[model samples]
Target: MDPWLTLAVVAGMVLAGTLLLNAIGARVKAEPLIAIVRAGLQLAALVVILKLVFTSMWLVLGWLFVMIVVAIVTSTKRIGWSREVLAAAGTAISVSAIVTVGVIVVTGITGRDPQHLLAIGGILIGNVMSITSVTAKRLREHLQESRDEIEGMLALGATPRQAAARFRGLSVSHALIPTIDSTSTTGLVTLPGAFVGALFAGSDPMDAGLFQLVVLGSILFGGAIAGTVLTQLLGAPKVLPQPPREAEEETAES
Candidate 1:
């Protein structure tokens, strides 16, 4: 496709989506517009950077680090920038991405091409970031809502970990729902981007399907690990502090 034509198409799509969102009274405000513009700028920058760094392993690693930092910063906006939260998200995403990508490389499923590595790594990291953010946000919200129940459990001699276990489980499960639903409906409801992109690049149907399967599996694994780790980290007593009885009573009186 011509570059100008592609740009026009993307711009049109963004505009249409923004209008539709406004029509529906969505609370996102100007985020869609901002995100679309930001994504275009970021992708343009990435294209230039990737062209320069795709030939060197060290450069590729540096680029991946940049991507991880971006992911962490973006995630911290949704899930607070607390030390434990950052540590949990960073550890979960890094470990799962490394393990998943390592398995793909070791098994010869994907080539050692730096471009391929960066593409796959970025996808894995992005998915994990979303999962971790969702888990953290949901866990905090649940903990806040279920404060009474948690305090009751605590009063009954249950540890903080034990008290928060149910909420943690729920949060992790909620975080993984999108991945689970996508996996369950892959062929019927959705033709994933990886599969479609592979086919567009002239890959065989079987090869494209295999690649998509790998991508899907990696996302599921990474998301699960990230969500679980985040929930566990957030479940700590220090992280999810209980309100004092006096304060609770005072607030109730107010």
Candidate 2:
């Protein structure tokens, strides 16, 4: 693709998206454009850094570590930072990345080279970060919205975890559904990035297909582990009572 053409098309697409969002009263006028610009800048920097990173195993490991830390921080911020949220998000993302990549490496599903490791590890870490953030945030929202029901369940002899089980399951399902749908529709509805990239790089069709399969599997595996582990770490919500003023107002009305 010509560089000028690429820039023109991207600019046009961004403008179109911005206009559509504005027309829909999305309330985010400039955020989408800003995010795109930021992403472009980040990718530009990554391209430069990856040149040196791909040459050294130690550098690749260090890069993965940095990715993990950024993932943790991003997830923690998204889910509302606190001691417990930080601990849960950090542990979930780190463990999921390690386990997912370790399995792929041990099974020889992907090459053990630094480039391969970075590619697969980066994908898992990124997906796990998103999964952890969505799962944790959704569970928190569910618990908050269903506070009365959860409290009633607690009063009825249900354990806190048991009371919140429905929300936890829903949150996990919500987090995993997009990945599951994407995997299910692969090749039929969409050509995944990994597969397309591999093909573009002149890999064999079979090799590209296999790599896409591995990537899809890794995404699901990492996401599931992150969601489940974060749920366990989160345990139960502490359902605090209504404030004194609200309680008295309700009492007076009753």
Q: What's model 1's TM-score?
A: 0.88
lDDT of 1 by residue, 51-80 (tens): 899879889888888888888778886787
Query: Where does model 2 exceed 4 Å of error?
Result: 240-254
After superposing all C-alphas onto the true structure, candidate 1 shows an RMSD in angstroms of 3.4
The C-alpha lDDT values of all candidates are 0.82, 0.88
Q: Please write out the lDDT profile of model 2 over residues 1-254, one tens digit for every residue.
A: 89789878897899899989899998788887888889888998999999999999999999999999999999999988899889999999988999999999899988899878998898889889999998987787677677788889989999988888888889999989888998999989988898888889999999999988999999999999999999987858665335456668999999
For candidate 2, give the lDDT of residue 210. Answer: 92
lDDT of 1: 0.82
Which 10-residue window of candidate 1 scores lowest in summed lDDT? 238-247
